[model samples]
Target: MAQRSPLDLPEGDPFGPDNLPYGVFTTSDAPHLRKIGVRYGAHVLDAGAAAATAASPHAELLGASSLNPLMAAGRPVWQAVRAELRDWLTNPAHRHAIEPLMHPLTTLALHLPIEVADYVDFFASEHHASNAGKIFRPDGDALTPNWKHMPIGYHGRAGTVLVSGSPIVRPHGQRLPPAEAPASPAPASAAPTPAAPSPSASSAPPRPVFGPSLRLDFEAEVAFVVGAPSPLNTPLPLAGFHDHVFGVCLLNDWSARDIQSWEYRPLGPFLGKSFATSLAAWITPLDALAAARTAPPARDVPPLPYLDDAAAEPGGFDLRIEVAVNGHTVSRPPFSAMYWTAAQQLAHLTVNGASLRTGDVFASGTVSGPRPDELGCLLELTWGGRDPLHLPHGTRTFLEDGDEVTLTAWAPGPDGVRIGMGEVTGHVVPAAS
Candidate 1:
């Protein structure tokens, strides 16, 4: 009896022919050389070598060490390459030629697929926003006044975006001191307590002390990668979303909450958010997620003409996400529950004539649902530390130095199959002295 081929994936395999997510990898023999790889079951297909062996015209694009060259070739090229790849894997005649190019996943070292040009993270989940407001500002309204009108986002540090499996060094910054407790009243029978020293007029305002962050957190998010570049002063409309976006990847925007609270006053996030961001190695193309598309939640407030997506195709993806800490499943947040769609976020991002560049990443911030167990971040899960999450190992309010956080998701595929979005994971380490 002949052994079964690796390409003959068993039924229900998430990385089947239908889900050929792309990545960059290096083999052990030649560690310095990187090649574009496609995930097929438990193996990584050497896409560049396969393209060359088939005498394909897109060989140069596939041969590049990074995905930027292929991505910048635009949608038509992207579609053509994807179709060709599917044919190569499915056609029996090419099996012998392709089988030799496949390598076991364990033997490859994966790297960040794209050269990140810019990054923008948005506050798009109503449930997450509401929970955060209730925890931090109990006396104020849960939702911000402008949240319903448009997607609120901030520019992030592109240089710090990291590949999955990278160690996260705890960041250091200023944090406000814990509030002082009032002195106990003296008993009437005892000597009166000496008068407490009063603050002088020249006393400086409360100074923030510097140290390692006490509130380290992880945000489970889904991000889209841009494929084509737009000219300066040209805004990408909502309809052009598919034309520019190449695919989606899981992202962990590691945050220092205490630092954020101290410095995010009038100017928004600075050192708190700029430290590091982790991204999955694989990128599932948008074309493969056709079955996952669904209508976004109905809007309470109508959007402006440019941002309006009422008549457009369904923009929300029905991806189900699971977050795990130390291998224990902690939360299952649904991506479909997001109030704002990625299309709307992209439109709003470029509404002011900002151009779209290839490799730009925009993430849907902290996907949380309406249930207690569906919260996305520790800030919400622990409710500002008033509540603690109990696990087999111990209880946790925020991340510790050795904790590992992993995020994984799957979207509905054709004929009841599931499309897996490979995980983004990071292990925390002590702050550098």
Candidate 2:
């Protein structure tokens, strides 16, 4: 693919590597759902207004132009908008017509690009899985028998997913009793050594009660947006998985380890994970990312034949993902550590003939690694806070109020400019009374 020239970058360069993700934003001058546009560098391509002035028939659809309505229209409309926008941004003649609507990218705040119907999280990273497993079940086994066979995942609360900048409330829930509340001192002994009280009679502090948790934490992962829809009985093949994917974004899956440990026994994560998940404001289209696609490292134990694609399509992305807390960089690694590919994740979702919706979402669970610093969540990072992480901000075992967490990603391609996924940021909030 040809890279965008630096000259083109000055005038809202849509092809710039850092601004690859497609998003919808509006200016204060024309504010309404009917007025929306895609961004590039310093420009905002007003799709709805431009199409209206040009007397284009599709102008009506573009009219109710925010991403919410566009997304409701499904894959057909998404492609239509992308195709038209691509031509206008890339051509000189259309550039003049669209330039009038260009607004500073820094001026607008982002809204949830799509109306999510359901959200699912997957254990896609091998390093993360192994690291997490070692924390959960240390000794020998790193994976459950079913893990190597398929992409394991759980359904998440779609309503809890929020856009960037939303304040994360401190979650209130049950916690283990604080280390026996420093057992009461025994009565002064008459002699050097006195008889000890009976174990049962020896009163100890009452067991801890259900209340707000103090051990709150954050989880960093990648999320993919579903553009197309598949019927309930349909089965999507691994070889053709990309057809269903619309784009990708950075996600922060917030967690309350104490609540999880107590509730996630037979069933998977519930209130612990269902509270809040933050996503970047913009959505990076799959087409814009074509140049950054690459194959992942070979799998160990050889995946089952049903899950194997044998390199039919790119199984990995060149994107370099990073995570930070309170302005401190945590992970500066690549996305290649994922054991299962997105195609496999989607294929597994539909193997049972389950239906998928256009606004559905899936998160790659805790993209941790061998090193302690590379761990995605505090649970594994601090070994349950038996050890606390010393950060530039200060020492922390888990997130505290006013703590800010941010996620950034970029891919350096043969094309001179780098393509980047913006960022998602949020600060912890005190629990509601």
Candidate 3:
């Protein structure tokens, strides 16, 4: 766990800070996927090939080829492989085991971390809730009647989730303002001016306009990868939630804010959330992050019995998370302030026996806090951009076309080597003309 030197990295640094996560990769010249690999520096230490030669319990998971077989083998196998991999890569002289299959991370391409079975996005951050409340009901309350009762979430479309680096096409949808107040005719006593046609009658058709949204937005969050499958009616104890999660990744839940505000009242986010979502390619194993876990803040009201985990650990990861527009890091503060924890959400998810499968994604919602600078999204950081945020490139209330958003996170640990989650980025394309 000590910080590795740059030389260790160049010798195919398997323990590089940003490369702590794992994912399948294939080089352009490789025929038919045949190995598993972990990102380190700019190289991938081919896990599959290394296991073939190394004497480790993980050899079975790395058998012959593609990572899909290993990934589907579930959590126990993943943990075994992670342990073996860390040992093989960290020892300076282990190249005899890893040399032949090694390749630069840049030359290879990342694949979808998993074949996601389902996706659920949770609104578990209190700061995010309060900020939204200020916009929707500024005059009254922050927490809703049902908010403190349980974590609120919506099932998301898994088919639409894409890996980092994929281009996001602008989504087209209907947009409209509230109906205008009716106009009144001039008073007879005023000797009315020439009569005018009714404004409403002369307006354009009311059908949905087809063009990319003008108010596209992004939600920065942490996602849990479900490793173990569950039965349809079994409830998982709050403390046991960790057993089912494989690892974690950074995610950007893209949104069409304008459309969301208009349509969410009836049932909640649909198209606004359905278009696209991008996730960090590498997945940081949960075991590696377990050492960094810290306690979350207490809720004012007592949680429902099933929702409470009396034995739950008091801390979450101490990761420093940030967002960058195009390539410029935003002025907002880091991610230490999130009010909700992923464990609580997962525990509640199966309270009724809802089956969970490997590859299911659960997002932490937008992480924000009391500090104005720590706000997670433009809607909060800018107070609706009533005040624009200054960036090295300029200032922005929200994203603009050709703009790219990137998210990165890291935590300091033993030695000089810090574990990190690589960047997840996406660019804004112009709306259809």
The most accurate candidate by lDDT is: 1
Q: Each model's TM-score?
A: 0.94, 0.85, 0.86
* lDDT (tens digit, per residue) of candidate 2 on 1-433: 9844322676323345334455666566645543555666655566677777777667776666445455545656666667776666666777667666666667676677677889998877777666555655555466666677788888989998998889999887765566642111111000111222334756763454576667787777888888677888888888656667778888888887776665564566777778999987778876667777788667776776667878577777777777888888976646766778788888888889988887788877777655656677777667767678889879988788899989887765445667767688989988999
The local lDDT score (0 to 100) that residue 267 gets in candidate 3 is 64
Expressed as tens digits, the lDDT of each residue in 311-393 for candidate 1 is 99999999999999999999999999999999999999898989988999999988999998898888888887778899988
What's the candidate order when arranged by decreasing TM-score?
A: 1, 3, 2
Minimal lDDT window, size 10, model 2: 184-193
lDDT, candidate 3, 1-433, per-residue tens: 8743422666323356334577777778874574566776766777766777885666766653434455556777877677777677767687555655667666887777677889998887777787776654556576677777888888889999988887776787755443521121111010112223345866854444545665677778888888778888988877776678888888888887655544454467777778898988888877767656777776687888877755677536667778888777663534556556677788788887898887889988777767776767777766654677787777777677888888888765555456777678888877656
Evaluate all candidate structures by whole-model CA lDDT and list the values in order. Answer: 0.88, 0.70, 0.69
Off by over 4 Å in 1: 180-204
- List clashing residue pairs in candidate 2: 17-418, 17-419
lDDT of model number 2: 0.70
Name the candidate, 1 or 3, with the larger TM-score value: 1
